[model samples]
Target: MKSIFFILIFTFSLNIFSQDQVLDITLKTLDGETTNLKEVTEKNSLVVVSLWATWCVPCKNELDAINDVYDDWKEETNVELIAVSVDDSRTVNRVKPLVNGKAWDYTILLDTNNDLKRALNTAIVPYTLILKDGEIVFRHTGYTPGSEDAIYEELKKHL
Candidate 1:
């Protein structure tokens, strides 16, 4: 009975702790404003948070592909994409110019210190996750040519 009770309590504690692990991290905007991920998730019903770096080509491609059809996705599902750049201090300067050049319509957040990256336990660039009501519904890493279709299909399922 004692062993069983301890197991149950441990599982229950994990359930509560996992929810805030990612959302509690602080993120910065392009203009140098700070905000919590929890606040952003609370306002939007569905949010797509992609962790990318300025120097990663695959990350840029993934964001560009999504940007092409982003408007349609928003209209159909009312989903918002928050592109979180994991660029470190030395290379962070390139983010703004690249974003302007591509004109991506995303809520760009900077993680210059990699705090959010560490919180998410992400190992690579182009990490993407879909959150609904602050809970992660789907998560995928890496990108392929037609991955956007799959992403849209996943978003549709959550709706």
Candidate 2:
């Protein structure tokens, strides 16, 4: 009977500890302001966090594709996209110029030291996450030509 009780207690503990959510990690904005990830998510019901780097072509393509239809997506679903640059200290300076050149309409944040990336256990660029109430609802790694459509479809479900 004691062994069974111990097993039940362990199972209960596992359930309680499994609710892991993103913590408030500080990141820099393009305007050189420090912001917290939790603060950003609280502003919107649903947020799309796109992790990308300046040198990644596929990441740029994914963002550009989303840019093309972002307005429409917002209009229909009220979803916000936060573009996170995982560019280390070496190429972090280029983020602003490239963003301006492309004229992306998403909130841009800089993860210079990849603090958020490591915290989230993301292993690659072009990683996208759908966050609801600061909890990660969906995640995708890598990008294809039509992946934006899939992203939009996922966003629609929460709307």
Candidate 3:
């Protein structure tokens, strides 16, 4: 009974730690400048973090959809979007070219080591979450057509 009690305590402690670990990750810009995710979130009232990959079609579609109305989003809600590429070493080279070609307006960051993905305990592309004052307020994975509308609604709720 004592051992079981200790195990339960340890599990509860780990859950608390993971809850705060999301924003503490360190990521780099495509230009190789290192920045902490928490610092980035602190600079914005609301931040939308999209964990994507170069090869994921749904990810690209979601970002492209968001980019179309991003300016309005910024103007209305002052929300900032950060697109974090979860590409590994083999396909990481495609990220810069793809971003350039798409001309996306969001801040792009590199997660070459998948540190953020592992930290978030997510295994899928197109994972999106909203952070308010550096704390995660919402999380969603996968995407469908017109899903950006849903995301926008969620942002408004937090604002």
- Per-candidate TM-scores read 0.86, 0.87, 0.87
Candidate 2: 10-residue stretch with minimal lDDT:
14-23
Q: Write the per-residue lDDT of candidate 2 for residues 1-159, one digit (tens) a residue.
A: 999999889867654554347668999999999999889889998899999999999999999999999999999988999999999999999999999999999999999999988776666889898987778788888999999999999998877
Query: Which residue pairs in candidate 3 have backbone atoms (N, alpha carbon, C) closer than 3 angstroms, thus clashing?
Result: none
Model 1 clashing residue pairs (backbone): none
Model 1 / residue 50 / CA error / Å: 0.3
How well does candidate 2 match the true structure in TM-score terms?
0.87
114, model 1: CA deviation in Å? 0.9
Candidates 2 and 3 compared: the better one by lDDT is 2
- Give the Cα error of residue 111 in candidate 1, in Å: 0.6
Candidate 1 lDDT trough over 10 residues, lowest sum: 13-22
lDDT by residue (tens digit), candidate 3, 1-159: 999999889867754665543557898898889998888778897999999999999999999999999999999899999999999999989999999999999999989999998888677899999988788888888999999999999999988
Best by lDDT: 2
RMSD, model 3, all Cα superposed? Answer: 4.6
In angstroms, the error of model 2 at 117 is: 0.7
